[model samples]
Target: MQERGALLEVVVLHPRDVPGADEGGADRLFLVNDIESGGLSPEPGTVSRLCRETEIPVRVMLRLNDGLTTTGGELSRLVGLAEDYLSVGAEGLAFGFLDSDLEIDVEVCGYLADRLPGVPWTFHRAIDSALETDRAWRQVRHLPGVDAVLSAGSVRGLDAGCDELVERAAADPEVARLLMAGGGLRGEHVPWLARAGVRQFHVGSTVRPGGSWTKAYVDAAHVRSWRMLVDDAVDHELARRTTPYT
Candidate 1:
């Protein structure tokens, strides 16, 4: 099981946004490019700079395109990019794959994991888009180096997936430990998820002014508020769990 304190991971599109996220108590930074395309792999130089400069862990995205399926040629490029990110000291990676049948692509995922041995990675939100949720979860459970799975419990994001997330976490201990509740996550969702035993959370545009991904940058105060909110919720949940029933 994950440790008791809740973790706040923030998405960073550019180097400038790094300070606010780090200073705001973000536990990690999900580095990606082109947020409008659901996040593509960022330039290696950017990863190098951020990883070199920041104390916080940065998990670089390992996707070349918008879709989950990768071509052989794209896979080669991705492997090369993964090497570059690792050479620059990226703490970890965020990636996922799907077959044409819309199922989790274990072969592809395992291949990449083999090439990037010992690197901790996240199975990104592709699980929410899989044809069968149970099958998807089963496929990812044993994948090497996958320490976390980012999901909203649905492709449409938290408003549509919050109940499922809470229920699934409550039902499965492993799910609760590995799930990083995110994607359209809001302040209101934190307590419910915490009570359900989810210890990690992700935020993107929500930490930006007006929740705008393109117009504004992540504000430290906004990220700090989320940090405080998640910490408080987790503390309450921990207290409730430990207190003897009267």
Candidate 2:
């Protein structure tokens, strides 16, 4: 496996968004439910199918709601679902835990992390919802067994403060990192983010139907388009960086 902050790696949203998702150049698959609320949580069967079939590593993210804060029962349910997914071949689990105050619940996250062995775990974007983003980063960086945080850095906009996020991750050694730059990311912005020190990225629109409320969802050609965009961006960067200057 490549190091955490390698260079411009893509993580597709849901399996459905990218039908032939496994074949794409994405480094990871964040399995979720494509509900009206924005996040995607797949059924056990769906996760199993992707894990059993896909060659790429599969990571399943469980959310308590459209935003942060999860209940004990909900956390348990996620753990159970994670077990099921793991048994069927899932490679990682993506989730976040927050206390009643809505801050990162290191204790609770540690509990869930303990339950999951071998499979890597992502703190998810719940970090972006904290009352304070800087503090959230500090707390999550200390969480045990956390593989990375799938965050856009600031809740205001994924692209707005990417430099801050990248700098924070780069400075923290205790925190293994993956700056999952998401939201408003396109073929054009891919290079900008790469140069900004963001190595990992998340893209969904290219795989799913665009618009907040499509009412009528259809083809997910966006996934293929996104894959192409990221692939091209990586190829372009590789060539540009490797060229010999005369």
**For this target, which candidate reaches the highest TM-score against the unseen true structure?**
1
Error of 2 at 205 (Å): 1.1
Give one digit per residue, the lDDT tens place, for model 2 in 152-243: 66776566656666566556534324556675565565665555445566765444444432332223355456656665665665566668
Candidate 1, residue 239: CA error in Å? 1.0
What local lDDT score does residue 15 receive in model 1, on the 0 to 100 scale? 81
Error of model 2, residue 192, in angstroms:
3.3
Q: Per-residue lDDT of 1-246 in model 1, one digit per residue for the tens?
A: 435799999999878888889879999999999888889999999998888768899999999989989999999999999999989988999999999999999999999999999999999999999999998998998999998999999989999999999999999989998999999999899999999999999999989999888888889999999999999999999988888988
Model 2's TM-score against the true structure: 0.77
lDDT of each: 0.93, 0.64
Clash pairs, candidate 1, are: none
C-alpha TM-score for every candidate? 0.97, 0.77
Off by over 4 Å in 1: none
